[model samples]
Structures are given as structure tokens and as C-alpha cells.
Target: MAKITYIQTDGTSTIVDVKDGDSVMRGAKLNGVPGIVAECGGGASCGTCHVYVDKDNTRPLSTMHAVEDELLYCTASPRLDNSRLSCQIPVSDDVDGLVVHVPEKQI
Candidate 1:
């Protein structure tokens, strides 16, 4: 399992262990991490699953499909450069220490 950390806008942090092949949204839902709505359930149709990933600048995120990028524009909150849909991010051993910042609002 990968240890994923979710940081809220208020600075509250939640850490959950998610098995490989599952999405970060799934981890939040399963572990009750707040601030992730996941309205589309990983479909990348709705943008409520948005999160700001804190990763090394030199390492680019993997598997960010065009649909995720398109849906990000529909988020209730303004998108940031590190913005990403949690559903689009799969949990894996490589991302064991993945840190994501949850926005203040998700609709």
C-alpha cells in the first residue's frame, strides 16, 4: 500500500494507505478524507475530485489524460498549476509519499 497524505486548506492533514491500482479519490472515500467530492466517481467527467499535488518539479505526473485536463476547468474553485483530479491519480508504490492539497471547496 502507498501512504498518501491529504492536506486541507485549513492545514489539517490526513494520511491513508491505499493499495496499488486504486485511485487517490478511492483512498479518500475509503478512509474518510474530507474535501474530495468525487462527483463523477473517477470518470473524469466532473471536476469535484480536484487536488493540488505536491511533487518534485522535475518529476511530471503520469497518466493525466486529456479528459482530466478538460474537466479541471469546470472545478468550483480556481485551478492551480499543481491541480489534478484525484480520481485520475492512481496510488502505487512509487507514490508512497504522495502529498496532495485539498481545496477549500468542492462542488
Candidate 2:
């Protein structure tokens, strides 16, 4: 399991043990972590699961796919260099201790 931290807009933090191969969005939903809406259920369709990966994190995430790249533009929050769809991030030892910041809104 990978330990992923989700930081909310109000400065709240939630740490969850996400099973390997599960998307970060799935982890948040399973653990009842606030902020991740996941309206598309990890289908990479809706951008409700958008998150900002910690810029200082050393772990490298998977390359963004074309679909995810396009969807990021539709997120409620302003897209940043670190913006990513939580559904596109799979949990594993490679990304253990990953920290993501949740935007203020997801609608």
C-alpha cells in the first residue's frame, strides 16, 4: 500500500493507505477524504477529481495522457504546472508518500 496525503483547501490533511493499482481518487473516496468529488468515478472524463501534486515531491508520476491533459483545462480551479487528475494517478511503492493539494472547488 502507498501512503498518500491529501491536503484540503482549508489546510486540512488526510492520509490514506491506498492499495497498489488503485487511483488516488479511489483512495480518497474509499477513505471518505473530503475534497475529491470524483464525479466521473476515475474515468478521466469529468475534471472534478483534479488535484495539485506537491511540486517538491521527488516521486515521479505517470505521464499525463491526452485525455487527462485536455480535461485539466476544465477544472474549477486554475490549472497549474502541478495540476493533475487524481484519477490518473495510480498508487504504488513508487509513489509512496505522495502529497496532493485539493483545490477550493470541484464542480
Candidate 3:
């Protein structure tokens, strides 16, 4: 299981043990991590699951695809270099201790 951390806007963090092959959005929603509004589920159709990949882990995360980039650009929050749609990140054993910071808002 991978240890995933979701940091909320109010400074509360929800840490969950994500199983391999699970998406970050699925893990967050299952663990009741607030601020993660996966409107389109894990389809990558909505950017509600936007997260900032910690600098240290950015390189290890999956590379952004064209669809993911489009979704990120459509998000209501300001996009960062490390911005990523959590749905695209599959939770696997290799991603243990992954930490993602949720944005202040998501539309």
C-alpha cells in the first residue's frame, strides 16, 4: 500500500494508505479527504482533483498527457509547474508516501 497525504485548505491533512492500481482521486474520495471534488470521477474530464505534486516527488510522478494538461489549464485555481490531476496518478506500491497538496479551491 502506498501512503498518500492530502493537505486541505484549513491545514488539516488526510493520510491514506492507497492500494496499488488505485487512482489518487479514488483514494482521497474513499478516505473522505475534503477539498477533492472529483466531479467527473476519475475520467480526467474535470480538474476538480487538482493537486500540487511536492517538488521532491514531481519527477517521479507520471508525465502530463495532453488531456491532463488541458484539464489543468481549465481549473479555477492557479496552475503550478507541479500541478496535476490526481486522477492521472495511479496509486501503486512504487508511490508509497506520496504527498499531494490540495488547492484552496476547485471548480
Candidate 4:
């Protein structure tokens, strides 16, 4: 299991143990982390599961696919260099200490 931290807009932090191969969105949804809406259920179709990857993380995430890249443009929060769809980020040992900040809105 990989330990992932989700920081809410209000500065609340939730740490969850996400199973390997599960998307980061899956970990939030399963643990009731109050940020990801996941309207498309990790299909990478909706941008509700958007997150900002902490710049301090040392590991590099997988390359974004075309669909996920396009969808990032539609997220409620302004997109940033670190913006990413949680559904597209799979949890693994490489990202054991991953920290993501949840935006204020997901609509």
C-alpha cells in the first residue's frame, strides 16, 4: 500500500493507505476524503477529481494521456503546471508519500 496525503482547501489533511494499482481518486473516495467528486468514477472523463500535485514530491508521475490532458482544462480550479486528474494517477511504492492539494471547488 502507498501512503497518500490529501489536503483540502480548508487546510485539512487526510492520509490514506491506497492499495497498489488503485487510482488516487479511489483512495479518496474509499476513505471519504472531502474533495474529489469523481463524477465519472475514475473514467478520466470528468475533471471533478482534479488535484494539484505537491511540488515537493520527489517521484515523477506517469505521463498524462490525451483524454486526461484535455480534461484538466475543464477543472473548476485554474489549471497549473502541477494540476492532474486524481483518477489518472495510480498509487504505487514510487509515490508512497505523495501529497496532493484539493481545490476549493469541484463543480
Candidate 1's TM-score reads 0.92
lDDT of 1 by residue, 1-107 (tens): 88888999989999999999999999999898999999878888889989998856333356778998898887988988899999988877878888999998988
Q: Which of 1 and 4 is ahead in lDDT?
A: 4
State TM-scores per candidate.
Answer: 0.92, 0.97, 0.94, 0.97
State residue 84's C-alpha deviation in candidate 1, in Å. Answer: 0.3
- Model 3: lowest-lDDT 10 consecutive positions: 54-63
Better model by TM-score: candidate 1 vs candidate 4 = 4
How much is 63 displaced in model 4, in angstroms? 0.7
How many residue pairs clash in all the candidates, one count each? 0, 0, 0, 0
Name the regions of candidate 2 deviating beyond 4 angstroms.
none
Q: What lDDT would candidate 4 get against the real structure?
A: 0.93
Which residue pairs show collisions in model 2?
none
> All candidates' lDDT scores?
0.87, 0.94, 0.88, 0.93
For candidate 3, list the clashing residue pairs, or say none: none
Clashing pairs in 1: none
Q: lDDT of candidate 3?
A: 0.88
Q: Which stretches of candidate 4 lie over 4 Å from their true place?
A: none
